[model samples]
Target: MKLRELAHSRTGDKGNTLNVSVICHDARHYEHLRREVTAERVKAFLGDVVRGAVERYELPCIGAFNFVLCEALGGGVTRSLALDAHGKSLSSALMDLDIAAPD
Candidate 1:
């Protein structure tokens, strides 16, 4: 299933860091996302989208995962040449994760 169908995302930009919170629609999909969405996958997905090194963490308390992508925002918005840094790039990149569909 599509990541959008499985979860909702909250994205943020702090200087060169792009912080993303992915909340799963259901707890059942947590393992699927956790197993499939690795740091490598996140890095590759965000390569063109964010432009940086990615660090992903799993949050058991929230049943969600957080991704802190460094140097992703192209240093800053003004320097990014009007790119829709958080909205366009981050979401598109996260969508590439091969998360399993809910059964």
Candidate 2:
């Protein structure tokens, strides 16, 4: 019941902030994600990497959830010495998030 089975994600970054948009394959699953894919949940999932705050914006019209992660890029892509400074793996990693599968 991983979220990936129901949705896909896109990610981008601007300095230390990163944004990940989770788009549901079908609009019907919006409510399910709204309940399970919470900001707190995402923040907890990402853990200490997010130093500031996590905010979620809903796009019901498009059946997508946009998660804005603050201070997540370590020290900005240019400065962070981490091998994956852009945090591209975050999207794939987040796909492992468990969600309730429809019956």
Candidate 3:
């Protein structure tokens, strides 16, 4: 029910920006993910944890949605402790996504 439970995250540093990729499992829930998760929502969820633009990508072959969080590492990896800026954390954020189990 969390991002940690639903998918894995990879963090990268590009200049003063942090690039994070949230790769979801159970590709079948892609539609639910698309409907429930949005850049604005993600920004609200992440809050000060990371800043910048959020982009969503759907990979039909993998049935996974990839979220690219830009400039979220708080001035790059060196300065970030990777804390959840909003208290909900990434896992909690993912849990917030409305996903339906296979019927």
Candidate 4:
């Protein structure tokens, strides 16, 4: 399943860092997300844009995961020439990551 079917996301950025939060629609699905949504997968999904590393923090109580993408903004909005340098749509893009459909 795509992440959007089970979760939703929000994003923020500071300089070259990007933070994307994935929140589960149901608490029961948190475990599945924890298993499936790895830093590796996120890094791979975001691809070349993420120049540094991917770090994932789990929030069990909130049934959410926060992904920190280092050096991902093309050098931040002020420095980045790329359109949408702020990475505002990154959360929406992340929802497209493929995962096993919940049974």
Candidate 1 residue 93 C-alpha distance from true site, Å: 4.6
> Measured by TM-score, how close is model 3 to the native structure?
0.60
Kindly indicate the candidate among 3 and 4 with the higher TM-score.
Answer: 4
Ranking by lDDT: 4, 2, 1, 3
Q: What value does the lDDT take at residue 33 in candidate 2? A: 91
Model 4 misplacement above 4 A = none
Worst 10 residues of 2 by lDDT: 94-103
Tens-place lDDT per residue, model 4, 46-95, is 89988999999999999999999999999998999878897878888999
On the 0 to 100 scale, the lDDT of residue 83 in model 4 is 85
Q: 6-88 in candidate 1: lDDT tens per residue?
A: 87788877776877888888887888788777778777766675566778889967779888888777666666755585454
lDDT of 2 by residue, 1-103 (tens): 9999999999999999999999999989999999999999999988888888999999999999999999998899999987889988888888899888865
C-alpha RMSD between model 2 and the true structure: 1.0
Candidate 1: pairs in clash: none
How close is each model in CA RMSD to the real structure?
2.2, 1.0, 4.4, 0.9
User: In what order do the candidates fall by TM-score, top score first?
Assistant: 4, 2, 1, 3
lDDT of each: 0.74, 0.91, 0.57, 0.92
| Candidate 4, residue 27: lDDT | 95
The Cα error of candidate 2 at residue 93, in Å, is: 0.7
